[model samples]
Target chain A: MSQNVEPFKGLKKLNRKLAKLHHILKRDINISTVSTPTNNLVLCNSGLVNGLTEDQVFEHFSKHGEISNITMLPGKSCCFVSFSKKDSATSAYECFNGKLNISQNNRPVYLSFVEEVPKPSIEVIWNELPPGLLVFKNFISTEEELNLLKLIDFNHEQCGLLKHRLVKHFGFEFRYDINNVDKNQPLDQSVPTETDFLWLKLAQIQPEFKGFKPDQLTVNHYAPGQGIPHHIDTHSAFEDPIICLSLGSSIVMEFKKDGTHTCVLLPQRSLLVMSGESRYDWTHGIVPRKFDIIKTKLGGYTCLKRTTRVSFTFRKVLSTGKCECFYRSKCDSFLNCNIEEKMAVQLEKMHVHKVYDNIANHFSNTRHKPWPNVMDFVQSFDSGDFLVDVGCGNGKYLSNNTHTFEIGCDRSANLIEICRNRKFEAFLTDCLSIPIRDNCIDGVISIAVIHHLANESRRLQAIQEIVRILKKGGKALIYVWAHEQVKNKQKSSYIMQDRKNRKGTKEMNGQCLTSAQQVSLDSGNITLPVHSNRSNFQADDLLVPWKLKGDEEENESVFLRFYHVFKEHELEELCLKVENVRILKSYYDQGNWCVLFQKM
Target chain B: MKLLTHNVLTSKCIRGVTVGYPLLIKATNVKVSEVEFKPDFVAKVLPKIEWDVLANAAESLGHWQNLPKELPNNYENDTDFLKKIHRVLLEVEVIQGELICPESGRKFPITNGIANMLLNEDEV
Candidate 1:
């Protein structure tokens, strides 16, 4: 009778009976058997997975089902995904078995169902955060907060706008004009005595901060839709463990480092302590918006509305000195671990000579007019006296004195060609090794050249080369760019002070100070921004940009030239080391330290 | 390169190349142009030149005709001898040549009146 029925309908009835039998068998099996089906488990493996976190594993496998748990075996490069619903697991296994394409480190993943599942190494901590960040909820009582607010004199006249918020500083005046705390200069007004109790209470909350003394307090008032911009507290300006207590509202602050973003909630009457990596490496800020959208576990966002808030940030001013932190990248004290001498030489060759070669034509065009001081030196030599110009780019000084028999030498072959084309005597050589016999030339002029050398020793070597070639009583002039000539007054003062600090310990040769030196020495105690107008002037040892005339709009094509702007005493010190050379004259002319010395 | 410039050129500045003076000239191209004669300049420059080396260099370039094999005792006042010295020092140019260092045997090339005295990194 079954064979006589419609054949397709009879096949469908038999398949349903088989499916029911298999389901009953799977439900009845309790032992780990090969044929037993697991609906809520998925097995994942990859050959090249590394450091795959639990959150990443969830992000990848959650689309298949509502993942109840994910245990990652980083050592084995495998993981287990458990779904909340059996049907979702079945669907995922059916769709992905033997055809899953998940990959890490360019290695494809394999997915399948297994008869036995291995135990996970450890349970993943779901909401663990990075170190060096602390947040306390409702840290102060309502009455205490009201008393603290009363102690603060909210004077609109004194509150200045720092970005989007109104800020007033106590103990140390945080200058918004300079965007840093002024440690050397004390403010006219001091911290109010009414807040003395609040300082003691903070010390009680965190005993480690008791030594910090809470000398500097910046009261910031933020209305709705107002927040501070991202910044790391200046490392040299303050000691560690900056404390901020919030009042009257809840807000979300974002912390970022490298590319990772961590959102922290600062609730009303909360205290946040930032130290260690959080204080130095991470930049913290609040976005100026009416609402903040936070991601939920179900891949949805919940917005938190903003309200007016006030915060008091307390810090201890760091004493002025070098920061000897092991974290070299973030330390603000030293410029860098003293650059190796060989590496410095390599940098000079790569940044200076190579750049001159690339911009030989354009550089020659801009360097047409010889400096008047250099011209005077070239013209001082008597006619028929043999002279050489070291680092003589394009031979600008070569033809300045037709009376003298002059020859030019430069490291750039292209510049040598330009000199040859102009029928000026020239040679291709390095300044350190001039290839000229000793005591042969009457005079040598090196203009705007020695500063291209990266280290003091190399600069001295260049000077020695000129001295070696000069005859007894022969004269030479050297010009180096001065650090004191920056166009901006504030920046120039900073550079001047930095130079003085670096040169303070060295004994001066009892030389009288010029008017400019007098001014810089008088202002040596002040501290200012070390990195201002970086586009025009980089570090003391840095690659500065040179814009080509026709390609000014294309920033990528700009050539980087190396320079070590010389301080006045530094140039004089170098000259003093060359034996038998007396400093005939030293002066600043048009942004260059010009020194004229005679080989005795 | 004029012999006057060659007078001051040496390979001693090159590391490992001691006794580098008196470079042997092998000129493939040579030319002579008139330079204003200055007898006093020649007289003053005479004490600085390696006389034997200059004479050898001039002979190797096949331009030593009428030149004395040895520097004369009274040449300071002899205009004829000073003229020859001037011609070799200032007028004659080695348009294309090689200057071989005697010690290291390093050859520096000269082209279009400019001598390439630059050294390799290791040599410098």
Candidate 2:
């Protein structure tokens, strides 16, 4: 008793700074002001959003006295912990208030007395799972689980490398870069025969799986501190009723949508089944940590140390490679998929198309010289060959390839005016849907245009449109800005050009200094990196500044243009997503990733 | 925009508009100019042409010169008809016009010989 009594002496120091503590709590999450000392204490900077679990709070505060309840606020950075007696609460306040960092990457915990805690139906919320979610216990015996684990060769390296966890796939390899599978390229090996018991047991339990035949398997090995990112499996890539069998250790997976979330406990040897709404709408993933907070035998939460966990995810590759789910808002491949566009399209209109139109004259003046390899590609075509130049700006390459008949198209109105003035036939059209008839063109060239697209689906759609117009054996040349500026100790021309002009003019785009903007997609809203215009890249998605020699009043007016620079080999990877196209050549040019593909 | 492009430009990229081909030409100002006729190029790609749509567009623009309503047999071997086909496909241009989608009835404006097929951002 005396050992714990001495810690309360620090309470005198905390009382002097009570006013600053009150502002912090009131400013962040809306909670009542600090009152006289009581049994309830609202601890700031120590909540689930700060990576503090309920068990961590219970273990830390219970040292002072008995814990009545610990409430973890959803999507908040504060929690309310109560004690049985006021003395115990005061001891915890004195011991930790403004004295210790609650988490490894945050400020010290700020404790203040409150009269009562916000009472939510805690037990009911945790007990119920999302709609169309099911769990079966003891689906496979321990001996069978061990034998199945042995079948996984850790030395195998077929699956694409992911930074978060170890993964292996059979039957058909899953492509994480596109978040889909190559339906035409199935592996020679199929799902193992040893895991037949797991499927048979699942089928016996659920009537919907009576005739289910899973054709693909992805085995994941996760260490204690590793986790997969939150995502829903691509709807167009797989069929319904995806199932996963947990073999090694138990963990808590979070299912979240909108602002609500539910933590699900998948114990060892249990099988989790997701279908319908749960499989199509809700996103699921584990929080990377060393321990998980879960309910103990006595109905009190306790810290469960995590261990190596392995799971086998079984899915049936959709034969038609499309999902016609009734949830039209959430479905990607629904029938008549002419829905509202994504934020990518909206962003392209504002940052890319508008910017080009505004700066068409200056841009055309600066971009008169065409790259040699691109010129070579155009000259290779025979005299009678006809080609369409998608995203052709100012017709810099149109007259150079006079041997071949070519018509240009772009998304800018001002730039197309310049093309018209130059007597080059051009039109206003989006690259995603070219107006040309199918299999009619001999070649296509898209230079520094694909990077302006904000998302992968749009980029792939653009490539597919190009391939749709090319005749058999017709070639296409594509180029995009590369993120790797200095390759093999040699600085690229893009980076070297900027080095000489680093004075007086300051970048006006300060989007990166603020929080990320919420870009609303069809399924839901996601935070994308804000537009930045710094010399060094803060992220893959950024904005580069184009300063104008401005009016007499203002010295300079800077415009920020958005660009999504590609990583090394990213262009080849995107080209592989298109069917019946062979990537003939993929190389790094002066500062861009270039690819030449031919229709097969 | 050339008659060749008008033959194939579709408003189907718009939501709920399935068949946007043969966009009805509503030209306020039409222009005619001579383009270098390349017989070999026109001969190689004659079959891909939708002759009916091209004829209809030419008729609407008042540039139709007794062109057949249907694709003629052995048109690739007929050099005289191929020159006429080349003139109608490349020489006739809709300088200032609006392309009306047959299904959606949405109009895409044409200014200075360039047809704007970009969907409105709000519509998208």
Whose TM-score is greatest here? 2
Residue A395, candidate 2: alpha-carbon lDDT: 91
Question: What lDDT tens digits, residue by residue, belong to model 2 across residues A188-253?
Answer: 889988777676677778877887778899999888988877888888889998999898998888
Question: What DockQ would you assign to candidate 1?
Answer: 0.41
Top candidate on DockQ is 1
For candidate 1 chain A, the 10 contiguous residues with the lowest summed lDDT are A512-521
Q: What interface RMSD, in Å and to 1 decimal, does model 1 have?
A: 1.7
Per-residue error (Å), model 1, residue A282: 3.3
Flag regions of model 2 displaced more than 4 Å: A1-11, A17-41, A44-53, A62-68, A74-78, A83-115, A119-124, A153-161, A296-299, A334-336, A339-356, A362-392, A401-413, A416-600, B1-124
Per-residue CA lDDT of candidate 1, range A522-577, in tens?
21221212223222232345455666656455544666566777754668779889
Q: Which candidate is the best by lDDT?
A: 2
Clashing pairs in 2: B1-B113
True contacts kept of 2: 0.47
Worst 10 residues of 2 chain A by lDDT: A504-513
